[model samples]
Target chain A: MDFNFTPEEEAFRDEVRAFLDENLPENGTRDMEAVAEFQRRIREKRWVGFSWPKEIGGGGGSIMEQVILKEEMARRKAPALGACFMGLAWVAPALIEYGTEEQKQRFIPDILDGKYQWCTGYSEPGSGSDLASLQCRAVREGDEYIVNGQKIWTSIAMWSKWMILLVRTQTDVEAKHDGISCLLVEMESPGLTVRPIKNMAGGDMFAEVFFDDVRVPVENRLGEENQGWKVTVSALAHERSSISEVYGLTRSLERIKVLAKSCHRNGRPASEDPGFRSRFARADARIEAMRLNGMRFLTKQLRGEPLGSETSINKLHRAQLEIELGELALEIEGGLGVLVQGDSAVPDDGLWQRHALSWPEVVIGGGTPNIQKNIIAERVLGLPKD
Target chain B: MNFGFTEEQELLRAEVRKFLDQNCPLEEVRKLCETPEGFSRSLWERMAELGWVGLTISEEGGGVGLGWVDLVVVLEEVGRSLFPSPLLSTVLAAKAVDLNGTEAQKSRWLPGLADGSRIGAVAITGDEGRLDAAGIALEGRPDGDDFTLDGEKLLVMDAQNADILVVAFRTGSGEEDLSLAVVERSAKGLNIEPHRTMDLTRRMGRLHFDGVRVSADALLGSAGSAWAAIEHLQDCAAAAVCAEMVGAAEGALKLTTDFANQRVQFGQLIGRFQGVKHPLAEMFIDIESFKSLCYYAAWLLDECSPEAPLAVSRAKAYASESFARIGVDSVQLHGAVGYTWEYDIQLYLKRAKWARPAFGDAEHHYQRVAKLRGF
Candidate 1:
């Protein structure tokens, strides 16, 4: 297979590089003014939602071009594509795919413009991995749906203005996956409350959101009632398309290399220690494998084949890799690794320490490793279900 | 940026798979294992006629000039079938000659090796069985228009079946002062003794080079300068071995998975139990990931990328451990019958045990990876 891109694709890559050169500062310098200006320029070029259909105010770029754009941006360590993280990531895709024309008109522009943040409302205390068995209830009124639910691990919920929520509209059904409905609920809805949760990393990025008979317009319902499962599944599908997470992982690897060269163990650079060196090399190998796996998935997508449980392979790798990389870096730093960000003795500003503690966000969120393993076993391998 | 094989490569894989399925089944391999050479000469000629042996040889060398990507496709199937042949050793010998042989030397050796009219084997490791400069203690003393070879080469693959041997020798004291000498197996003063191996699908031999003399022209490259070529050959071999390991592991997993799907315990298919199924899933994941590494390593070698050495070690190091693990798990999942000689699973486990250490064991490659990555 040809690993080299076509000349035309190379030209697009060149264009992206030139654009980044002009707008993005060297050494990954960032300030609010520069970041805002860069976003504006990229949005003007319609590169924000580069792969989304053009009819929806997206760049409508080819998948390959989108990859190039992302590669260039990531190589330069630019800020993420849009300011509204979850909104631009999945919410907009779901809205575009399942939102009513009126709903699209109301929310799509706001998402594209990064006007406000959106958080997911999927998991609950009882519904972490077995998500479809969620017990959150929504009862349809005359023209609105009254929602009552508690969503846990709602990332960025405290800062988000809205939530893409899943609620059970019918209690009795043939299967647990049936009777679920998706709603675009305002965080300001009368009975809704968001309490930020302090994770082990001592960060408040995730929150527990509660709803007590919150009123949501029936029009805000995404897709048909009892079809939110389909909408949620499709929305998550969009998340797998780019495989850009590999770039982030690769960048982390480069940082680890630098830290290894600087940090000492046994009065020599840790990079020279047999145990540390082998561990780092193994990390490098695993990351390369993950990157190649991502490329394989991308190849399937480019061939017009839909990716399914195969994405779980990389997801499983990424889950382990995140922890592996962080731990490796921490071990290289020796005792100083225990120090947090503000400690003067801390290495890499305690980035690895934070990273080492951030495994739950990746390892447990979306789906746990066990869940991914089960999916791979049953769905991909054709093994009998557990 | 496509991470897929070309149509021709896929076709070659399928063709080899079909040919092996029909002509060189496990029973055939088992039968061949009982032979003196542990090789199937008829199957080797058939594969050669199909242009399998000369896939990586340039067209000018009297064979189809292709890349490692194409050769690996056939090699993987050969591995899957547990085919008993000297194809890998022959390819490695041919590679040594092609990479460092002079025009005259190339003309003297490549065509025969390419056409499978002559078999070849590599003698790199000595008594230590180490695949490094330290391992090549076979001394070669400079003489008038010739070099005198002395020392023992152990674990020489296909040595009994090879017409010629590419022997790595220490021409000087420096670690990098290693050179390759291509000597005919019939050279005077050379003794070949076959060694029994755990994996009977292939043969290994010990070569006692008692003052075996070869002309200066027999040297593949300049004296004390073959270290790089040797490393390159090892990378090619490692990458190829990784492909084979992936194939062999996949085969074992497939057999075990099928068994799980069919066998019942407690009135339910064993595959329905998480205990059985989860290990199967883990095996599948390892195979898939290792396959990616293997192919990527092949691609890197094909392009002669700077990353080829590291990638090769990565693929080898990872596959070496995982393939053995898969072999063990496959047997474990098969239950009592898995350990029986009557069962085919034993073939793969044996293959894995032998192949894991063939082209630098896991520990060696891991350390190589560290060195290459500038650690």
Candidate 2:
């Protein structure tokens, strides 16, 4: 029935918050210096892979503690760890669960100590939400697998040193989910190219990665042949439950609250209006709900209940909530909400309006709302497939 | 920081859901929709008997001391059945009183509310404004031992069945000079006029107090401070309403998915087509998102966070918009059959339309959110 942190958890939160206060770079920009400093902090404090097992050079904390850290970091309005989320949350977990001993030894410590950055090469132009339909080809060549394909919206590819890629290894298999296999590919290998994509958020966060006969050691294969779908699914499950969306929503709520108080309506403070009061109540409620939902999901994971299709529910809700919150900020700002970043007339921060504009990426990226719904129907409700 | 329910709460939810499934089925909703009063008094009493009505009341007040999350679970089931009762009004009124009322007032009103003997309704709106207690023009002049009340309250839900009406009034000339008073329906010079609304599943009325006399003790809480109490009650109620909307949205989504799987079009079940499936998928997503927001809002209320007002607004606004959109899409996916009154889709649509506008519409809440966030 309680929602407050225990004294120990609270103390841990304080400690983390204090550390962030001292170590977080003062530069507000998400520039290379900020990224480098963030990586350095991870290396200095070993906070990058808090969820990884102790054998992998991590603190081996509880999942709740990981969630707590994420929430606390977000509450302080700190930037992401910038240590390759794909490597830590996705690839590393998959490796722990299914990788060979050698693969784990080679990859885990490198990722944990921030020596390597990883990008996920799951989606292509033809296969986005329908990831099982990937057309990427990887064929065995002696002791190596020659990889050839293009991955769209591959985040941090330009910054990453390695990639956990899914490719079609056996073309004539019975089912799409069965024929694919996962491989670890070196980003600096010959014939590899990375072209950065400018996102609406005004960041070059994603890239189009091309692998033209890039030679990866066969020992880099993540699991058995024709089992890439399972690995991919497991990785996605980790991503969904990681409470990353909670961080984003928390930051958005804080930004919105500041906007509401400082914004004026007719001669009085906008916060004084009954309408404004009501809306403030709602935004706060949704963020709290998202936080609680994350906790519930974690509880379920701890209890060994199948995570199931409910993660889709969390992703879907968070995307729409973020959009609505962004849109609400714009509405409150009136014309200012729609102001571009460079517009001089805007006050406080032009980023609120920018946030409003960039809100749709959440809904469109990851798994689209439509795709998440199908997952809920087919997997959660067990509705008959047509 | 636990968000998952304890086994006891889960058991309670299961029990309530089972009871609603058996007794307050959709057929009962259909029958009640056609009846004069949208809700059944006998059923209300039965709920009171089962201690459902008193679930949120403190143990000191002759009731269970469950928190907001527990109430949300019960409300969700009530919503799933579309059960017509003053459950929402009674619970909200009880909450308002609990939060602000004097010991005497609590002792006088809570037992009846807990046991369903004295139904209550809140009158915070007039014809033009929506739940703005400040806009009330109701005047109350002090007499020897009582006050003479004069004003009208519009769109009071379930006022016909309520024995006591908690009316908001302006005691001073200032916009914030508002007060709440408990006026009995049987009082002289009082008028109750029931009106038909968009959703027939809930009842609404206008209450006119023309020189109605009430004792000084009739005030629910401190005169001007009633606004804060009312706002708190409204936020809590909004959370419950959003939870209900989430329930209805979920039901509508399931119904549409079932229809899409079974109904044939173009020599195939419509579910196979992206046109039909995509929208249904989107609706499912919207419903899930609404669920998370709704649940979080409820949890926030239980935690009593200072940020609760903002969260409640977001939850209601999102749920209202999502539920209305999902209701329309569900009907559209069902084709001609969904258009008919007998098809049950309209029932959900009507409920959503009613619930969405009850406390505040989506746009209204969004604007409020804008102001809170410094838009």
Fnat of the models, one by one?
0.74, 0.44
Compose the digit string of candidate 2's lDDT tens values, residues A1-386. 55677898888888888888777776476577775777678566656777666776766767667777777776666766646667777788888889998888888877776676788898899999888889989989899989888899987899888888999999997777878999988889999999999986778888999889999888889989888888864532332364656676767666666776777778665556666566555655455555656666776776767777776766766777777777767777775665676778785558766676676667887788777767766676555554
Q: Please give fnat for model 1.
A: 0.74
Looking at candidate 1 chain B, the ten consecutive residues that score lowest on lDDT are B124-133
Once fitted onto the true fold, the runs of candidate 2 whose alpha carbons sit more than 4 angstroms away are A28-41, A77-85, A124-126, A141-161, A187-216, A235-289, A302-304, A313-365, A381-386, B96-101, B175-177, B222-225, B290-306
Off by over 4 Å in 1: A25-30, A235-243
What TM-score against the true fold does each predicted structure earn? 0.96, 0.85
TM-score for model 2?
0.85
Tens-place lDDT digits, model 1, residues B142-244: 8886889987888888898889899889878787778888999789999999988898987888998899997888998988888888878888988988888
lDDT of 1 by residue, A242-341 (tens): 3577788888887888998999998988888889777777777777778788788888878877777887888888888899999899999998887989
- lDDT, candidate 1, at A109: 82
The 0-to-1 C-alpha lDDT of every candidate, in the order given, reads 0.86, 0.76
